[model samples]
Target chain A: MKAKVTVRLKSGVLDPQGRAVQHAAESLGLQGIQEIRLGKVFDIELETTDETEIEKILETLATKILANPVMENYEWEIIQS
Target chain B: MKAKVTVRLKSGVLDPQGRAVQHAAESLGLQGIQEIRLGKVFDIELETTDETEIEKILETLATKILANPVMENYEWEIIQS
Candidate 1:
Protein backbone atom coordinates (compact mmCIF):
# COMPACT_ATOMS: atom_id res chain seq x y z
CA MET A 1 0.00 0.00 0.00
CA LYS A 2 0.96 3.58 -0.62
CA ALA A 3 -0.12 6.49 1.53
CA LYS A 4 0.26 10.21 2.00
CA VAL A 5 0.46 12.11 5.26
CA THR A 6 0.10 15.86 5.64
CA VAL A 7 1.18 17.70 8.75
CA ARG A 8 0.32 21.36 9.18
CA LEU A 9 0.79 23.86 11.93
CA LYS A 10 -2.31 24.79 13.91
CA SER A 11 -3.98 28.11 13.23
CA GLY A 12 -2.50 29.92 16.20
CA VAL A 13 1.07 28.70 15.80
CA LEU A 14 3.74 30.99 14.42
CA ASP A 15 4.99 30.13 10.94
CA PRO A 16 8.18 31.99 10.32
CA GLN A 17 9.04 30.00 7.22
CA GLY A 18 5.73 30.90 5.59
CA ARG A 19 6.24 34.54 6.43
CA ALA A 20 9.67 34.45 4.85
CA VAL A 21 8.30 32.96 1.68
CA GLN A 22 5.62 35.63 1.49
CA HIS A 23 8.24 38.31 1.81
CA ALA A 24 10.34 36.67 -0.87
CA ALA A 25 7.37 36.59 -3.24
CA GLU A 26 6.74 40.27 -2.63
CA SER A 27 10.36 40.97 -3.38
CA LEU A 28 9.89 39.24 -6.71
CA GLY A 29 7.00 41.60 -7.53
CA LEU A 30 4.21 39.09 -6.88
CA GLN A 31 1.18 40.91 -5.59
CA GLY A 32 -2.19 40.43 -3.84
CA ILE A 33 -0.91 37.68 -1.57
CA GLN A 34 -2.36 37.85 1.93
CA GLU A 35 -0.82 34.84 3.62
CA ILE A 36 1.24 31.71 3.10
CA ARG A 37 1.35 28.71 5.37
CA LEU A 38 3.69 25.76 5.07
CA GLY A 39 3.31 22.08 5.78
CA LYS A 40 5.00 18.70 5.25
CA VAL A 41 3.90 15.78 3.13
CA PHE A 42 5.13 12.25 3.46
CA ASP A 43 4.63 9.63 0.80
CA ILE A 44 4.96 6.16 2.24
CA GLU A 45 5.02 2.66 0.87
CA LEU A 46 4.36 -0.53 2.77
CA GLU A 47 4.77 -4.23 2.17
CA THR A 48 1.26 -5.07 3.29
CA THR A 49 -2.00 -4.36 1.46
CA ASP A 50 -4.43 -5.05 4.26
CA GLU A 51 -6.75 -2.13 5.01
CA THR A 52 -6.83 -2.75 8.75
CA GLU A 53 -3.04 -2.83 8.92
CA ILE A 54 -2.78 0.35 6.89
CA GLU A 55 -5.19 2.10 9.25
CA LYS A 56 -3.25 1.12 12.32
CA ILE A 57 0.06 2.11 10.81
CA LEU A 58 -1.20 5.48 9.59
CA GLU A 59 -2.69 6.35 12.95
CA THR A 60 0.54 5.57 14.70
CA LEU A 61 2.60 7.46 12.14
CA ALA A 62 0.48 10.58 12.22
CA THR A 63 -0.03 10.88 15.95
CA LYS A 64 3.25 9.63 17.29
CA ILE A 65 5.95 10.95 15.01
CA LEU A 66 4.64 12.92 12.02
CA ALA A 67 3.08 15.72 14.00
CA ASN A 68 3.38 17.68 17.21
CA PRO A 69 -0.13 17.37 18.58
CA VAL A 70 -0.03 20.58 20.57
CA MET A 71 1.03 22.79 17.68
CA GLU A 72 0.14 20.83 14.56
CA ASN A 73 -2.52 18.59 13.06
CA TYR A 74 -1.97 15.68 10.71
CA GLU A 75 -4.08 13.68 8.28
CA TRP A 76 -3.32 10.60 6.23
CA GLU A 77 -4.91 8.79 3.31
CA ILE A 78 -4.20 5.67 1.36
CA ILE A 79 -3.28 6.24 -2.28
CA GLN A 80 -5.10 4.14 -4.83
CA SER A 81 -2.81 2.90 -7.49
CA MET B 1 -9.01 32.99 -3.18
CA LYS B 2 -6.93 30.18 -1.75
CA ALA B 3 -4.62 27.65 -3.33
CA LYS B 4 -2.45 24.70 -2.30
CA VAL B 5 0.88 23.90 -3.86
CA THR B 6 2.76 20.65 -3.42
CA VAL B 7 6.47 20.43 -4.14
CA ARG B 8 8.11 17.02 -4.24
CA LEU B 9 11.60 15.83 -5.03
CA LYS B 10 12.19 14.27 -8.40
CA SER B 11 12.15 10.48 -8.31
CA GLY B 12 15.89 10.07 -8.89
CA VAL B 13 17.04 12.54 -6.31
CA LEU B 14 18.43 11.23 -3.04
CA ASP B 15 16.07 11.89 -0.16
CA PRO B 16 18.14 11.64 2.99
CA GLN B 17 15.36 13.10 5.12
CA GLY B 18 13.03 10.37 4.00
CA ARG B 19 15.58 7.70 4.73
CA ALA B 20 16.14 9.14 8.16
CA VAL B 21 12.42 9.03 8.82
CA GLN B 22 12.20 5.44 7.71
CA HIS B 23 15.02 4.50 10.00
CA ALA B 24 13.32 6.28 12.85
CA ALA B 25 10.10 4.42 12.24
CA GLU B 26 12.00 1.15 12.25
CA SER B 27 13.62 2.13 15.53
CA LEU B 28 10.13 2.62 16.94
CA GLY B 29 9.33 -1.02 16.05
CA LEU B 30 7.05 -0.26 13.12
CA GLN B 31 7.50 -2.86 10.44
CA GLY B 32 6.63 -3.55 6.81
CA ILE B 33 7.63 -0.08 5.60
CA GLN B 34 9.35 -0.16 2.25
CA GLU B 35 10.02 3.49 1.54
CA ILE B 36 9.30 7.03 2.59
CA ARG B 37 9.64 10.32 0.71
CA LEU B 38 9.23 13.90 1.82
CA GLY B 39 7.57 16.88 0.17
CA LYS B 40 6.28 20.34 0.93
CA VAL B 41 2.87 21.96 0.83
CA PHE B 42 2.07 25.65 0.70
CA ASP B 43 -1.31 27.09 1.57
CA ILE B 44 -1.66 30.49 -0.01
CA GLU B 45 -4.36 33.13 0.11
CA LEU B 46 -4.79 35.99 -2.28
CA GLU B 47 -7.08 38.99 -2.39
CA THR B 48 -8.22 38.39 -5.96
CA THR B 49 -10.87 35.80 -6.82
CA ASP B 50 -10.40 35.89 -10.60
CA GLU B 51 -9.53 32.54 -12.06
CA THR B 52 -7.09 33.99 -14.55
CA GLU B 53 -5.32 35.90 -11.82
CA ILE B 54 -5.17 32.88 -9.58
CA GLU B 55 -3.73 30.75 -12.36
CA LYS B 56 -1.01 33.22 -13.18
CA ILE B 57 -0.10 33.63 -9.53
CA LEU B 58 -0.04 29.91 -8.83
CA GLU B 59 2.09 29.21 -11.86
CA THR B 60 4.59 31.76 -10.72
CA LEU B 61 4.57 30.57 -7.15
CA ALA B 62 5.04 26.90 -8.01
CA THR B 63 7.66 27.39 -10.66
CA LYS B 64 9.64 30.33 -9.41
CA ILE B 65 9.44 30.15 -5.64
CA LEU B 66 8.04 26.96 -4.20
CA ALA B 67 9.87 24.43 -6.33
CA ASN B 68 13.33 24.15 -7.76
CA PRO B 69 12.75 22.99 -11.31
CA VAL B 70 16.00 21.07 -11.55
CA MET B 71 15.38 18.98 -8.44
CA GLU B 72 11.68 19.15 -7.61
CA ASN B 73 8.26 18.91 -9.24
CA TYR B 74 5.32 20.99 -8.14
CA GLU B 75 1.56 20.94 -8.65
CA TRP B 76 -1.11 23.29 -7.41
CA GLU B 77 -4.90 23.49 -7.12
CA ILE B 78 -7.41 26.04 -5.97
CA ILE B 79 -9.26 25.44 -2.73
CA GLN B 80 -12.99 26.11 -2.89
CA SER B 81 -14.21 27.74 0.26
Candidate 2:
Protein backbone atom coordinates (compact mmCIF):
# COMPACT_ATOMS: atom_id res chain seq x y z
CA MET A 1 0.00 0.00 0.00
CA LYS A 2 1.00 3.58 -0.62
CA ALA A 3 0.03 6.77 1.12
CA LYS A 4 0.25 10.31 -0.17
CA VAL A 5 0.41 12.88 2.58
CA THR A 6 0.22 16.62 2.23
CA VAL A 7 1.24 18.96 4.99
CA ARG A 8 0.51 22.67 4.85
CA LEU A 9 0.84 25.67 7.11
CA LYS A 10 -2.33 26.82 8.75
CA SER A 11 -3.96 30.05 7.70
CA GLY A 12 -2.45 33.26 9.18
CA VAL A 13 0.92 31.54 9.61
CA LEU A 14 3.87 33.36 8.08
CA ASP A 15 5.69 31.54 5.27
CA PRO A 16 9.06 33.03 4.46
CA GLN A 17 9.74 30.51 1.70
CA GLY A 18 6.49 31.41 -0.01
CA ARG A 19 7.40 35.06 0.12
CA ALA A 20 10.79 34.29 -1.33
CA VAL A 21 9.21 32.35 -4.16
CA GLN A 22 6.82 35.20 -4.85
CA HIS A 23 9.74 37.61 -5.07
CA ALA A 24 11.55 35.23 -7.38
CA ALA A 25 8.51 34.98 -9.61
CA GLU A 26 8.27 38.75 -9.84
CA SER A 27 11.92 39.00 -10.78
CA LEU A 28 11.37 36.35 -13.42
CA GLY A 29 8.72 38.53 -15.07
CA LEU A 30 5.86 36.17 -14.22
CA GLN A 31 2.95 38.48 -13.56
CA GLY A 32 -0.49 38.00 -11.95
CA ILE A 33 0.87 35.91 -9.10
CA GLN A 34 -0.84 37.31 -6.04
CA GLU A 35 0.21 34.89 -3.35
CA ILE A 36 2.08 31.64 -2.76
CA ARG A 37 2.19 29.13 0.09
CA LEU A 38 4.63 26.29 0.24
CA GLY A 39 3.85 22.86 1.63
CA LYS A 40 5.24 19.30 1.74
CA VAL A 41 4.20 15.97 0.28
CA PHE A 42 5.28 12.57 1.50
CA ASP A 43 4.99 9.51 -0.67
CA ILE A 44 5.15 6.48 1.58
CA GLU A 45 5.08 2.83 0.72
CA LEU A 46 4.25 0.26 3.36
CA GLU A 47 4.61 -3.51 3.43
CA THR A 48 1.08 -4.13 4.51
CA THR A 49 -2.06 -4.21 2.42
CA ASP A 50 -4.61 -3.70 5.18
CA GLU A 51 -6.43 -0.43 4.63
CA THR A 52 -7.30 0.07 8.28
CA GLU A 53 -3.75 -0.62 9.42
CA ILE A 54 -2.30 1.70 6.76
CA GLU A 55 -4.60 4.51 7.81
CA LYS A 56 -3.61 4.10 11.42
CA ILE A 57 0.09 4.13 10.58
CA LEU A 58 -0.21 7.15 8.35
CA GLU A 59 -2.20 9.07 10.95
CA THR A 60 0.53 8.55 13.52
CA LEU A 61 3.30 9.49 11.09
CA ALA A 62 1.53 12.62 9.91
CA THR A 63 0.92 13.90 13.41
CA LYS A 64 4.11 12.81 15.07
CA ILE A 65 6.69 13.68 12.44
CA LEU A 66 5.23 14.96 9.18
CA ALA A 67 3.62 18.10 10.54
CA ASN A 68 3.86 20.65 13.31
CA PRO A 69 0.40 20.45 14.77
CA VAL A 70 0.50 23.90 16.29
CA MET A 71 1.15 25.62 12.97
CA GLU A 72 0.44 23.09 10.24
CA ASN A 73 -2.29 20.79 8.97
CA TYR A 74 -2.13 17.47 7.12
CA GLU A 75 -4.32 15.25 4.97
CA TRP A 76 -3.60 11.88 3.47
CA GLU A 77 -5.13 9.27 1.20
CA ILE A 78 -4.32 5.68 0.39
CA ILE A 79 -3.16 5.09 -3.14
CA GLN A 80 -4.04 1.98 -5.15
CA SER A 81 -1.83 0.60 -7.86
CA MET B 1 -7.62 31.65 -9.89
CA LYS B 2 -5.45 29.26 -7.91
CA ALA B 3 -2.76 26.80 -8.96
CA LYS B 4 -1.66 23.78 -6.98
CA VAL B 5 1.75 22.57 -7.97
CA THR B 6 3.41 19.35 -6.81
CA VAL B 7 7.11 18.88 -7.35
CA ARG B 8 8.81 15.55 -6.83
CA LEU B 9 12.18 14.03 -7.42
CA LYS B 10 12.41 11.85 -10.49
CA SER B 11 12.79 8.11 -10.11
CA GLY B 12 16.33 6.84 -9.43
CA VAL B 13 17.22 10.17 -7.82
CA LEU B 14 18.81 9.99 -4.40
CA ASP B 15 16.79 11.56 -1.60
CA PRO B 16 18.69 12.02 1.63
CA GLN B 17 15.75 13.73 3.25
CA GLY B 18 13.53 10.75 2.69
CA ARG B 19 16.08 8.42 4.17
CA ALA B 20 16.39 10.67 7.22
CA VAL B 21 12.65 10.68 7.63
CA GLN B 22 12.56 6.90 7.45
CA HIS B 23 15.14 6.64 10.17
CA ALA B 24 13.19 9.06 12.27
CA ALA B 25 10.05 7.03 11.83
CA GLU B 26 11.81 3.87 12.93
CA SER B 27 13.06 5.64 16.05
CA LEU B 28 9.53 6.74 16.73
CA GLY B 29 8.40 3.07 16.77
CA LEU B 30 6.38 3.35 13.56
CA GLN B 31 6.65 0.06 11.73
CA GLY B 32 5.70 -1.22 8.27
CA ILE B 33 7.10 1.84 6.54
CA GLN B 34 9.09 0.40 3.64
CA GLU B 35 10.04 3.51 1.68
CA ILE B 36 9.44 7.23 1.70
CA ARG B 37 9.95 10.11 -0.72
CA LEU B 38 9.56 13.77 0.12
CA GLY B 39 8.24 16.39 -2.25
CA LYS B 40 7.08 19.99 -2.32
CA VAL B 41 3.75 21.58 -3.01
CA PHE B 42 3.00 25.16 -3.94
CA ASP B 43 -0.37 26.82 -3.62
CA ILE B 44 -0.42 29.88 -5.78
CA GLU B 45 -3.17 32.41 -6.17
CA LEU B 46 -3.30 34.53 -9.27
CA GLU B 47 -5.10 37.81 -9.86
CA THR B 48 -6.34 36.87 -13.30
CA THR B 49 -9.09 34.43 -14.27
CA ASP B 50 -7.89 33.88 -17.80
CA GLU B 51 -7.17 30.16 -18.09
CA THR B 52 -4.85 30.39 -21.06
CA GLU B 53 -2.72 33.13 -19.50
CA ILE B 54 -2.64 31.34 -16.16
CA GLU B 55 -1.46 28.10 -17.77
CA LYS B 56 1.32 29.92 -19.54
CA ILE B 57 2.43 31.63 -16.35
CA LEU B 58 2.32 28.45 -14.28
CA GLU B 59 4.20 26.53 -16.94
CA THR B 60 7.06 28.98 -16.79
CA LEU B 61 7.16 28.98 -13.01
CA ALA B 62 7.05 25.19 -12.78
CA THR B 63 9.81 24.73 -15.30
CA LYS B 64 12.22 27.52 -14.46
CA ILE B 65 11.65 28.22 -10.77
CA LEU B 66 9.62 25.49 -9.07
CA ALA B 67 11.40 22.42 -10.37
CA ASN B 68 14.81 21.36 -11.60
CA PRO B 69 14.26 19.64 -14.93
CA VAL B 70 17.34 17.53 -14.48
CA MET B 71 16.27 15.91 -11.20
CA GLU B 72 12.69 16.86 -10.41
CA ASN B 73 9.30 16.76 -12.13
CA TYR B 74 6.30 19.01 -11.51
CA GLU B 75 2.58 18.90 -12.15
CA TRP B 76 0.01 21.62 -11.56
CA GLU B 77 -3.72 22.13 -11.80
CA ILE B 78 -5.80 25.29 -11.81
CA ILE B 79 -8.27 25.60 -8.97
CA GLN B 80 -11.53 27.48 -9.21
CA SER B 81 -13.38 28.72 -6.19
Candidate 3:
Protein backbone atom coordinates (compact mmCIF):
# COMPACT_ATOMS: atom_id res chain seq x y z
CA MET A 1 0.00 0.00 0.00
CA LYS A 2 1.01 3.59 -0.62
CA ALA A 3 -0.12 6.69 1.16
CA LYS A 4 -0.02 10.30 0.14
CA VAL A 5 -0.12 13.04 2.73
CA THR A 6 -0.58 16.75 2.33
CA VAL A 7 0.31 19.08 5.15
CA ARG A 8 -0.60 22.72 5.19
CA LEU A 9 -0.65 25.74 7.44
CA LYS A 10 -4.06 26.39 8.92
CA SER A 11 -6.14 29.07 7.27
CA GLY A 12 -5.46 32.66 8.42
CA VAL A 13 -1.88 31.73 9.14
CA LEU A 14 0.88 34.16 8.26
CA ASP A 15 2.99 32.53 5.60
CA PRO A 16 5.73 34.90 4.54
CA GLN A 17 7.13 32.47 2.03
CA GLY A 18 3.70 32.01 0.49
CA ARG A 19 3.23 35.73 0.35
CA ALA A 20 6.52 36.10 -1.46
CA VAL A 21 5.45 33.51 -3.98
CA GLN A 22 2.19 35.35 -4.51
CA HIS A 23 4.05 38.58 -5.16
CA ALA A 24 6.36 36.89 -7.60
CA ALA A 25 3.45 35.22 -9.36
CA GLU A 26 1.63 38.48 -9.79
CA SER A 27 4.73 40.11 -11.18
CA LEU A 28 4.97 37.29 -13.68
CA GLY A 29 1.62 38.31 -15.12
CA LEU A 30 -0.61 35.87 -13.32
CA GLN A 31 -3.51 38.24 -13.04
CA GLY A 32 -6.30 37.62 -10.55
CA ILE A 33 -3.96 35.57 -8.43
CA GLN A 34 -4.35 36.72 -4.85
CA GLU A 35 -2.76 34.60 -2.08
CA ILE A 36 -0.35 31.72 -2.01
CA ARG A 37 0.23 29.15 0.72
CA LEU A 38 2.99 26.56 0.81
CA GLY A 39 2.73 23.04 2.18
CA LYS A 40 4.22 19.55 2.20
CA VAL A 41 3.28 16.19 0.68
CA PHE A 42 4.61 12.82 1.52
CA ASP A 43 4.57 9.72 -0.69
CA ILE A 44 5.03 6.72 1.52
CA GLU A 45 5.38 3.14 0.34
CA LEU A 46 4.39 0.89 3.14
CA GLU A 47 4.99 -2.76 3.93
CA THR A 48 1.72 -3.53 5.61
CA THR A 49 -1.70 -4.25 4.12
CA ASP A 50 -3.97 -3.81 7.11
CA GLU A 51 -6.33 -0.85 7.06
CA THR A 52 -6.58 -0.50 10.82
CA GLU A 53 -2.82 -0.60 11.22
CA ILE A 54 -2.43 1.99 8.51
CA GLU A 55 -4.85 4.27 10.28
CA LYS A 56 -2.89 3.97 13.49
CA ILE A 57 0.31 4.60 11.59
CA LEU A 58 -1.12 7.66 9.93
CA GLU A 59 -2.22 9.07 13.28
CA THR A 60 1.29 8.83 14.60
CA LEU A 61 2.64 10.15 11.36
CA ALA A 62 0.43 13.19 11.48
CA THR A 63 1.20 13.96 15.07
CA LYS A 64 4.93 13.44 14.81
CA ILE A 65 6.16 13.29 11.22
CA LEU A 66 3.61 14.96 8.96
CA ALA A 67 2.98 18.10 10.96
CA ASN A 68 3.82 20.20 13.93
CA PRO A 69 0.79 19.64 16.14
CA VAL A 70 1.21 23.18 17.40
CA MET A 71 1.13 24.94 14.05
CA GLU A 72 0.00 22.77 11.17
CA ASN A 73 -2.82 20.50 10.12
CA TYR A 74 -2.68 17.55 7.73
CA GLU A 75 -4.89 15.27 5.64
CA TRP A 76 -3.99 12.00 4.03
CA GLU A 77 -5.42 9.36 1.74
CA ILE A 78 -4.16 5.88 1.17
CA ILE A 79 -3.52 4.68 -2.36
CA GLN A 80 -3.59 1.05 -3.30
CA SER A 81 -2.12 0.56 -6.70
CA MET B 1 -12.97 31.66 -9.36
CA LYS B 2 -10.44 30.12 -7.02
CA ALA B 3 -7.37 28.15 -7.99
CA LYS B 4 -5.23 25.68 -6.15
CA VAL B 5 -1.68 25.20 -7.31
CA THR B 6 0.48 22.35 -6.20
CA VAL B 7 4.21 22.74 -6.73
CA ARG B 8 6.71 20.00 -6.20
CA LEU B 9 10.17 18.84 -7.08
CA LYS B 10 10.19 16.64 -10.13
CA SER B 11 10.26 12.93 -9.51
CA GLY B 12 13.79 11.51 -8.94
CA VAL B 13 14.91 14.82 -7.50
CA LEU B 14 16.61 14.84 -4.14
CA ASP B 15 14.73 16.84 -1.57
CA PRO B 16 16.76 17.15 1.58
CA GLN B 17 13.98 18.85 3.50
CA GLY B 18 11.69 15.96 2.69
CA ARG B 19 14.24 13.45 3.86
CA ALA B 20 14.61 15.31 7.11
CA VAL B 21 10.90 15.23 7.65
CA GLN B 22 10.83 11.52 6.87
CA HIS B 23 13.46 10.86 9.50
CA ALA B 24 11.57 12.94 11.95
CA ALA B 25 8.40 11.03 11.23
CA GLU B 26 10.11 7.70 11.71
CA SER B 27 11.51 8.82 15.01
CA LEU B 28 8.02 9.77 16.07
CA GLY B 29 6.92 6.15 15.62
CA LEU B 30 5.22 6.46 12.26
CA GLN B 31 5.55 2.90 11.08
CA GLY B 32 5.40 2.04 7.39
CA ILE B 33 6.43 5.58 6.53
CA GLN B 34 9.38 5.47 4.22
CA GLU B 35 10.26 8.55 2.14
CA ILE B 36 9.03 12.08 2.41
CA ARG B 37 8.95 15.02 0.02
CA LEU B 38 8.09 18.60 0.78
CA GLY B 39 6.16 20.79 -1.61
CA LYS B 40 4.07 23.95 -1.89
CA VAL B 41 0.43 24.64 -2.63
CA PHE B 42 -1.18 27.95 -3.48
CA ASP B 43 -4.77 29.04 -3.05
CA ILE B 44 -5.63 32.03 -5.15
CA GLU B 45 -8.91 33.85 -5.17
CA LEU B 46 -9.06 35.33 -8.60
CA GLU B 47 -11.05 38.17 -10.10
CA THR B 48 -11.50 36.70 -13.52
CA THR B 49 -13.73 33.81 -14.64
CA ASP B 50 -12.34 33.12 -18.06
CA GLU B 51 -10.57 29.80 -18.37
CA THR B 52 -8.32 30.95 -21.19
CA GLU B 53 -7.14 33.93 -19.22
CA ILE B 54 -6.57 31.75 -16.17
CA GLU B 55 -4.45 29.37 -18.23
CA LYS B 56 -2.25 32.14 -19.46
CA ILE B 57 -1.99 33.47 -15.96
CA LEU B 58 -1.07 30.08 -14.54
CA GLU B 59 1.65 29.72 -17.14
CA THR B 60 3.28 32.89 -16.00
CA LEU B 61 2.69 32.06 -12.36
CA ALA B 62 4.25 28.63 -12.61
CA THR B 63 7.24 29.88 -14.50
CA LYS B 64 7.83 32.84 -12.23
CA ILE B 65 6.21 32.42 -8.82
CA LEU B 66 5.05 28.90 -8.17
CA ALA B 67 8.29 27.20 -9.08
CA ASN B 68 11.88 27.67 -9.98
CA PRO B 69 11.98 27.11 -13.72
CA VAL B 70 15.27 25.31 -13.28
CA MET B 71 14.39 22.69 -10.68
CA GLU B 72 10.66 22.46 -10.13
CA ASN B 73 7.37 21.81 -11.89
CA TYR B 74 3.83 22.75 -10.90
CA GLU B 75 0.23 21.84 -11.62
CA TRP B 76 -2.88 23.84 -10.81
CA GLU B 77 -6.64 23.35 -10.88
CA ILE B 78 -9.31 25.99 -10.84
CA ILE B 79 -12.13 25.74 -8.34
CA GLN B 80 -15.56 27.22 -8.82
CA SER B 81 -17.95 27.55 -5.95
In order of DockQ, best first, we have: 2, 1, 3
Question: What residue pairs are clashing in model 3?
Answer: none
Off by over 4 Å in 3: none
Model 3 / residue B1 / CA error / Å: 1.5
The sequence of per-residue lDDT tens digits that candidate 3 reaches over residues B35-67 is 667777777777789988987787777776568
Model-by-model lDDT, in order?
A: 0.93, 0.95, 0.77
TM-score of 2: 0.97
**DockQ for all candidate structures vs. native:** 0.87, 0.90, 0.66
lDDT of 1 by residue, A1-81 (tens): 899999999999999999999998999899999999999999999999998998898888888888899999999999975
Error of 3 at A56 (Å): 1.6
- Candidate 3 residue-wise lDDT at B32: 70
Fraction of the true interface contacts (Cα pairs closer than 8 Å across chains) found in each model: 0.82, 0.89, 0.76
- Report the C-alpha lDDT of model 2 over A1-81, residue by residue, as the tens digit: 888999999988999999999999999999889899999999999999999999999999999999999999999999995
Interface RMSD for candidates 1 onward, in order: 0.7, 0.7, 1.9
Residue B64 of model 1: what lDDT? 83
Q: Residue B51 error for model 3, in Å?
A: 1.7
- Candidate 1 residue pairs in clash (backbone atoms < 3 Å): none
- The TM-score-based order of candidates, best leading, equals 1, 2, 3
